[model samples]
Target: MAKDKLRKVGEVAPEFHLYEADGAKVSLSDLLGENRYVLLYFTSTEEKSRCDRSGCPLKENLEKLIELDVTPVLIDVDPVEEHKRFKHDHNIKFLMLSDPAMETIKGYGVYEKVNIHGIEKEKIVSTAFLINPEGRIVHVWEPKKIEDSIDDIINAVKKLKGM
Candidate 1:
């Protein structure tokens, strides 16, 4: 956990390639220098209530983000089969990448071992990052709680765009 503190704002984001739910490879460089803001949300199994609650807000706010010209990327740390079902169930049209080994998840510092319901411990953190066109992190929401609203992300994007 502490070993993987997220890359700080103003630092060039680390680049890596991960397979999307649709089987396409997506790399950080793909978004860099694209002249568009990139919004990345690292998610869980999506079947879990925590994952659902964490992801629902982003889905609900997709239209507004699209309106703002922000490209939303969803990273699923669950298995491929689960990710497929989750994608179909949620009808998520945005980029959904799969990181089964959690290599990318740990790389981004969103992977953590936490106990949910006081029963089992697992990676339960939900995080989002707003990266500017220059590849530097402009804003970040590490371990974003389900109670947080999409407005938080939208406002941050709006603010970053003005910079």
Candidate 2:
């Protein structure tokens, strides 16, 4: 499989407006206006095994992220209701935005065409981006392992704060 081109550090992050689980609209510019940094996590809730392995740890560490003044946002290709239920089931505290059209996913350059269970589908590759208040991407992590991504994100947040 070919790797998708991703936004790199120092590039101005793409702006997007997506709906949260509660149907409230969230704009990237709005987040940047309020927070010093935004941690955008692109993931899926459809695959339970993968979601549990990757999403759970991030859910558990919400407080740490908050303390660092980084707003963590979860983006999924699922519908709003599905995202709502997923958050409820997992007790996730952060905002989980739904991008059913996958426009934001594609705009972020995380969308990939992959074969799953003998079926070809376009899915958002699990990725994390740290965008500074100036709307510049400060860190990008395309993890080979979900477990490692959590630590990478935390370290990236710390490093960004230190800078």
Candidate 3:
């Protein structure tokens, strides 16, 4: 299958509304409406290999992100209950969104159909995007290694904010 084209920097991010782990709805526009920069991550907790090292980069840079006043949001194609459990297990303090239907995931061009554990399923690719307060995508990281993406992400945010 052909991969969906990713939204590039300077383009308006595709708007989406998904539920957080607590079942609270969150919208991109609402987040931008408050002038908050968003570091959006498309991820999944099912793959042990990817999941094992997935959140470390974000977790390592959480304090720096907070210092920059950026809101980190993790979007996964998993159930709300699962997301809640994952967040708890990982000590994730930021918002963890549930995209069970993969609507928001595909909308962002991060959904990939792959074979996992010998079963075919649509899973989210490991990708991150930084949206500025004006709702434009300021940075994008299509990391080859999920665990090694933090430095690039942090540097992009710093460059975008002129810090």
- Please report, in order, the local distance difference test score of every candidate based on alpha carbons: 0.71, 0.79, 0.77
Single out the weakest 10-residue window by summed lDDT for candidate 3: 46-55
Work out candidate 2's RMSD over C-alphas: 2.6
lDDT of 1 at 89: 81
Q: What total of clashing residue pairs does each candidate reach?
A: 0, 0, 0
Q: Please, what are the lDDT tens digits per residue for candidate 3 over residues 42-134?
A: 876654235555556666678998887788888887788887887788777888888888887777788667887999987677788999998
Local lDDT at 48 for model 2 = 31
RMSD of each: 3.4, 2.6, 2.8
lDDT tens digits, residue span 61-81, model 2: 888888888889988778889
lDDT of 2 at 133: 87
lDDT of 3 at 114: 85
Q: Give the 10-residue window scoring lowest on summed lDDT in candidate 2.
A: 46-55
TM-score of every model?
0.80, 0.86, 0.84
List, residue by residue over 59-86, the lDDT tens digit for candidate 1. 6777988877788887766665666777
In TM-score terms, candidate 2 sits at 0.86
Best by lDDT: 2
Give candidate 2's whole-model lDDT: 0.79
